[model samples]
Target: MSKLKFFVFVLFMIISVSEIRSQIVINEIMYAPLDANNEWFEIYNNGITPVNLQNWKWKDATSTIRTITTQSIILSANSYLIICQDSNKLKIQFPGINGIISTNFMECPE
Candidate 1:
């Protein structure tokens, strides 16, 4: 009975850890941009399922934590999301770029 209980506990721990693992990844970052206030970072969803980004928090190496989005935003599987400090500046910098642009990150560390 004790051995069976230990086995069950181990199985439960494995399942719990897998479920808690995140599929979102930070793909790219423009930490030092030539244009002022043009800092941006790209996040990719590598999982098969879409993930909601509402209220998700992130912080740079030298910045405080900030919410990713106030509104409900879904990041589709195998898709990229760009979080920028200045949307207008990013658009002007990369005129032909595409994908979801979020202006939630107020500032990025240089």
Candidate 2:
């Protein structure tokens, strides 16, 4: 095979492996402030089935874990859910957003 063809094959293999490994993937994260107090992370349901986030948790690089305990959240297949610091603030910033789905996370210990 040509060098270009070989490169494409390797890239395709890597991406296929990644997709297989990721059941529920973190699609986007807003670390820095979009405004003064807007911080959020988006999770994507990459699997074919819906996922229940009833007791799911998120942990940062520092191992700070926060569980979702407020309400039961179910994310459908090929859908996205944005977990935010303040859903109200997020809605205010993006007025066109029809609905906001979120839960409060406990403050991580320093």
lDDT of 1 by residue, 6-97 (tens): 99999999986575346788999888778747878899988888888877778766667777777789888998998887777778878877
Q: What is the alpha-carbon lDDT of model 1 when measured against the actual structure? A: 0.78
Model 2 poorest ten-residue lDDT run: 99-108
Measured on C-alpha atoms, candidate 2 has an lDDT of 0.73
As for candidate 1, its clashing pairs are none
Which prediction has the highest lDDT against the true structure?
Answer: 1
Query: How many residue pairs in model 1 have overlapping backbones?
Result: 0
Model 2, span 23-105: residue lDDT tens: 68888878877473587888888898777777676686568887754467778888888887688888887787642565667
Q: List residue ranges in candidate 1 displaced over 4 A.
A: 1-21, 104-110
Residue 40: error of model 2 in Å?
A: 0.1
